[model samples]
Target chain A: MYEGVVQDLIDELGRFPGVGPKSAQRIAFHLLNSDPADINRLREVLGKVAEGVTFCEVCGTVAEQQRCRICRDERRDATLVCVVEEPKDVLAVERTGEFKGRYHVLGGALDPLSGIGPDQLRMRELLARIGTDEITEVILATDPNTEGEATATYLVRMLRDFPGLTVTRLASGLPMGGDLEFADELTLGRALSGRRAL
Target chain B: MYEGVVQDLIDELGRFPGVGPKSAQRIAFHLLNSDPADINRLREVLGKVAEGVTFCEVCGTVAEQQRCRICRDERRDATLVCVVEEPKDVLAVERTGEFKGRYHVLGGALDPLSGIGPDQLRMRELLARIGTDEITEVILATDPNTEGEATATYLVRMLRDFPGLTVTRLASGLPMGGDLEFADELTLGRALSGRRAL
Candidate 1:
């Protein structure tokens, strides 16, 4: 423990995801030793972010206004919607520079064990958007885990009733530049089953 | 790569020690998704810590008032002073519950390459404290690296001029439960050199 305010700062920092107690102490001390101007800047930015940032009305991604940047961009393919679990996933997909479609963040994947269901997510908004927007394809880009698979399967079954809508899942196989020997059984099996001829 | 305020939050989080860009984005998004009440609490705590916390005038440790808790406690041994590089080090030593003395934080170890000399440290305060107080023993508890060793050597040389003052360094040896086979050469050598008769 430390002085009252120092301990309070460490406890607050420890609440952040992935920061352990040791890391919290280190960061708290670092901030304490840093320049007053720098600390003020960080504080200003944190307060500004809390007040200025909000969820996009259309797609649930983080935004400064009613709509996120991707949703506001008319150059992106409106007919194709990439459904992801979180806003962070939107950034992950964007890093490839391959997907040029709009995104719908589901807030989180379905984990019945954790009490997360379709109604708990933004599934209702997603369905409404799909029906109103002239979307032809919906790509499920959730994580490759049990919760993600369950969410995708549920979506696929529900979207089946849509007359012209097509649904697809991102391919799961060996990663680029990865060795075959080190690949896991499920990934190696998927790669074998989805093999292509040279 | 993100909306205005979101990107600003990420950039600010990335400035923290050991937090990379990816971690910054993750934390920013996590904060965005968290309840506004929680975010406000964190912000309040940060502001409170920055405004209220001040360095102890007696020992240079973190405090909310003029002196630190340890320095204010009359029951502690005023005649023994443990010199460390940072306030965090004081916590580490206190956790051991072995030292019942006061502390003197040097701010940082002597690293000439980093332009940190004796003048840059709280060395003047330490010398003044020793001269004024009835301190009989000074323990050099700096880290066991080049900078720490350099600082200890420098302090020992400087303190030699004082009469009837005992100077000591913390014992250097293999850590508890550490395996001999895995021990580095330098550590093993120190363990051998500092071997006890028990």
Candidate 2:
């Protein structure tokens, strides 16, 4: 609905994930009104990220170099690996400061309807990492959704062949600080069944 | 929270209007996974918009040239002028297709706390336009919010000195297709007061 360059900018911004047409327009106008230096800086950063960022060769996580920071950090427990569905999930887990293990980003979870299968993910690379690395425990920390469960189930069945390797899934329960009354039935059921002796 | 260029991209994307930290990170990762050509295209468009777009000399609206399309169009009713807050407001009024008059963008409203007074806006330009042009009617089409109402009130008082000019404010009432039950008290009051005979 705008003229020339303004419309072009809006169209480009609309391509970003979660940026709808209204948001795209608002952003474009905001950029138009902002300092020229700020816009130039954004453009420069975008160009640099597009050219520099690449998937980690070992774990499929986003990296500026061959391997991601977690993979390169020798201090992290290499014996324990936490497997997640995407690079963002790695950040989510890391924020808790609970897991000292390395991560393996699967690129995506299993969704046959969307044409994403085990082969489409980094399953082969994961298997290779487990076989070669002295990984003692594998933590399946994928989402609690259906696709995540499916992917975890597939991985558990495959990992059964590796002797002396322990496999574990992240616990499912009412979130920390959440009210019991607000907990969904499925989550409440799981929390009740998985209750541990206090 | 990310490495090098990846974090830089997220920071830049976060600067955009309505994009929070999490959304910025998601957009950054999405761009990292997207084609290099797409990113380059976005960069090129941003550069073009920053370099090319300038405010219209006639009405203060964003334009590629000195004059906006509405000001340049000879067929538009020059005798009727509609006053609005920002360049975006011009687009909103235009979308309604109810008015064929030219526009005079006020740049902003009269916010006393923010130190934005009449002098800060394009009031001088608006008065100059009214003095020079054969404008028969001046419609105050500012927003329905507090600042917009203040601006409209200020303009109405200012325009009173000009003889042979019909100054009017846009009618305030319940929005079209909005349920009466959901309408706020102020809006319901305005709707009742402004009710027209069948």
Candidate 3:
């Protein structure tokens, strides 16, 4: 352990996801040698984040203004909304350049054991959007894990009441550059079941 | 990329050593969900480090007071001093429970290519301590790398001028519990050359 604030800094940094004790020590020492300007910049950024970084009122994704840039853009297809688990998912979908529609950030997927349910997510807001925004479709782009699948199933049941709303899920198959021989059983099973004519 | 302060926070976190872009993104989102108090604590620690973390005036290691804990302890042998490259090195040696003497942190080893020389380190302070503090033995415990070896050689030449001062260097050989077969030629040769009659 180090003296005073240096050790304190290491302990604090270790709390971040994926940062082990050794990594925390390395980062702390690097910061110790960093310029005051650089350290102040990090502190200022953290201060801003702690002071309540704005989330889009409509989509629930982090935003600068009242809504996210995607929500603000007129060219985005508002009628075709993409339902995602978090703001990071929005970025991942956006990177593909295949999603031109707006997004509805669910904050997190369903995990009852972890005390996360529909009430914990933005399911009510999503229903509200479908009812009032003249939405034609909602793409369920949650992760392929248990919690994400549960959230999708719950959303499907809740959304069945609405008419003429097409619900789709992101395809699950072999990754673009993956080798079939090395594919896992679950992924290969999914690919075989969801095979396309093409 | 994210928008507003969220993106700024991610960018700032990426500046830390070993935090790549994806890791930076993950850390940013983790911090976004972390309790406000946790984030505040990190900010406060960085603030203290930026405001100028105190260093031991005598040994040049990070300290809470005018001197380090080892330096302040009256039971510690002031007649003996272990020389190290950094404060972290001091901790490494202290963990062995063998060295009960105080330490003199050199901050860094000699690396002329990086424009660091004897003046850049605590060479003058070390010399002054030998002259006035009546120190009997000085142990050179810098790293085993090229820069550390150069520093030890320079210090050896400089400390030879002292009449009764006994200067020593750490033994070089294969690490404990390490396989002799896997040991490099350099280490194997050092162990052979420095053989003892046990």
TM-scores for all candidates: the values are 0.93, 0.90, 0.97
Ranking by lDDT: 3, 2, 1
Residue-wise C-alpha lDDT for candidate 3, range A37-100, written one tens digit per residue: 9999999999998988899999999999998899999999889999999999999999999888
Two-way DockQ contest, 1 vs 3, winner:
3
lDDT of each: 0.91, 0.91, 0.92
List residue ranges in candidate 3 displaced over 4 A.
Answer: none
- Candidate 2: C-alpha lDDT: 0.91
Ranking by DockQ: 3, 2, 1
Query: In candidate 3, which residue pairs clash?
Result: none
**In terms of docking quality, how is candidate 1 classified?**
medium
Candidate 2: Cα lDDT at A36: 86
For each prediction, how big is the interface RMSD? Answer: 1.9, 1.6, 0.9
Better of 2 and 3 by DockQ: 3
Binned by DockQ into CAPRI classes (incorrect, acceptable, medium, high), candidate 2 is medium
lDDT of 1 at A107: 94
Give native contacts recovered, as a fraction, per prediction. Answer: 0.62, 0.73, 0.79
Which ten-residue region of model 2 chain B has the weakest summed lDDT?
Answer: B46-55
Q: Which ten residues in a row have the lowest lDDT in candidate 2 chain A?
A: A46-55
